[model samples]
Target chain A: AQSVTQPDIHITVSEGASLELRCNYSYGATPYLFWYVQSPGQGLQLLLKYFSGDTLVQGIKGFEAEFKRSQSSFNLRKPSVHWSDAAEYFCAVGPLMDSSYKLIFGSGTRLLVRP
Target chain B: DAGVTQSPTHLIKTRGQQVTLRCSPKSGHDTVSWYQQALGQGPQFIFQYYEEEERQRGNFPDRFSGHQFPNYSSELNVNALLLGDSALYLCASSLWGQTSLDTQYFGPGTRLTVL
Candidate 1:
């Protein structure tokens, strides 16, 4: 079975400070990893994804993630944090079972940006 | 292009009642997948529909079912709903048959509350 783990349940960062959210995945084969953000009462938005190549992947909102195969980690990072960046972050591993390519997600990490 | 969209932003139902949530996939997307997100947890895969057929399913019971239309829109139906079934239902869209590696685009979820 495939699974994702986001060890941090909550993280508070001061505005303009660098941010990092750790994610670890368990998959039998090469994994399709993704990061999604969900604002309060809002739909989820894709932050970035890693399919193959370029362990370092950049996403919207000036976010980036590095996929370290050896560590089984795909951690999300931002050079500076903003108030609007506060949201729930989820890490997922996908395309596991059937052709529909279902995704398995982690519990989530809540980010709080202080002004 | 409009991203995926879900109907009935919020609903309140009693235990043993039935409810149906609808979703329209993003333009040009042929596959729709459903997920359940509890109040403080990550989303859990429910099932996926492609070409009007269920291509994959998660560990959910038969009480949860769905259908896809010729137009590529989908519906999630829950029968004899329990209080535990209360959660935000999310719909995701992706292009089927193009490449198995495509990312899923999510819609604003429908929140269901069971009393």
Candidate 2:
């Protein structure tokens, strides 16, 4: 079955420190990968997506993710952490079907930024 | 353009009761998808509706049903709700065409509490 795995349930980063969140997926074909961030009690915002072509995709809020096909991973990274960046991050994979496309999401990783 | 929107930011219900959640898609988006996000977990795809039809669905039971309107709005209905059914219901909208890739935009979820 197709699924996404975000191994880290929670991560803590000091302010201004570099950050990396790992993700892995299981799918039959080249999957469409996506990263989304959700603030508490708010809707999810798209961080980035990998459809085709480039392995490295840039997203909002200075976040980027590299899609490694061989490893079945798409890890999200940020150069520096901000207090506002603390939120729940999810990794998702979507494989298009005949008439519909739905996302398969990982459990999610919550980030905590320390001052 | 207006973003995707959902109604009733929060709800409290009892077991065996039914609930209906509404969603209005983002401008120009033609497909609506519903997801259930439990506490501390990623959102699980429930179903997707397009052109007033249920185009695709996840592993949800028959108790979970949905409908799409001509204006690109949608509704998710759950029957015989249980305690496990309590979750944050999210609505996402996207455009699915032959040449375009799916990029979903989410609405502020409805927090459901089953007691």
Candidate 3:
């Protein structure tokens, strides 16, 4: 079955530090990948998505993810971490079927930014 | 344009009760999907509706149902609510048939608590 795995349940980094969140997916065919961030008591916000073309995809809030087909991974990265960036990040893989996009999401990674 | 919106920001229901959550898609979006986000977990797809019909569903039981209207607004209904059924219900909208690659925009989500 198709599934997304976010190995890290939580990661802590100092403010202004670089951030990297790992994600791996298992799917039979090439799939659309996405990264979303959610704050406490808030809905998810789309950070980035990967379809065809360039592997490096940039999203809002200076977040970017690289799609590595060989590794079946799409990892999110940020050059500088801010306190406001302390939120839960999720990785999702979607496949189009019957004119619908059904997404399978990973458990999520919670980021804690330290001062 | 207005973003995806959900009604009843929070609701409390007792066991065996039923509850309904509403969603209005973002402007120009024609597809609506529902998801359940348990605390500390990622959002899981419940179902997707397009053209006023259910196109695809997740592994949820029949107790979970949904409907979509012509204006692209939708509702999620849950029957026989269990304590475990309490979660944040998220509504996402996108233009499915218009493009092969679509990004789902999420609403603020409805928090349902079962007592």
Best by DockQ: 3
lDDT of 1 by residue, B1-115 (tens): 8889999999999999999999999998999999999999999999999999999999999999999999999999999999999999999998876444666789999999999
Query: Candidate 1 on A1-115: residue-level lDDT in tens?
Result: 6789999999999999999999999999999888999999898898998878899999999999999999999999999999999999999998654345588999999999999
| lDDT score for residue B5 of model 3 | 97
Clashing pairs in 1: none
Q: Arrange candidates by DockQ, highest first: which order?
A: 3, 2, 1
Q: What interface RMSD, in Å and to 1 decimal, does model 3 have?
A: 1.7
Q: Distance (Å) between predicted and true CA of B65, model 2?
A: 0.7
TM-score against native, each model: 0.96, 0.96, 0.96
Supply fnat for every model shown.
Answer: 0.53, 0.61, 0.61
Q: What is the lDDT of residue A13 in candidate 3?
A: 99
lDDT of 1: 0.93
Question: Candidate 2: which stretches are off by over 4 Å?
Answer: A98-100, B98-102
What does the lDDT read for residue A63 in candidate 1? 99
> What lDDT would candidate 2 get against the real structure?
0.92
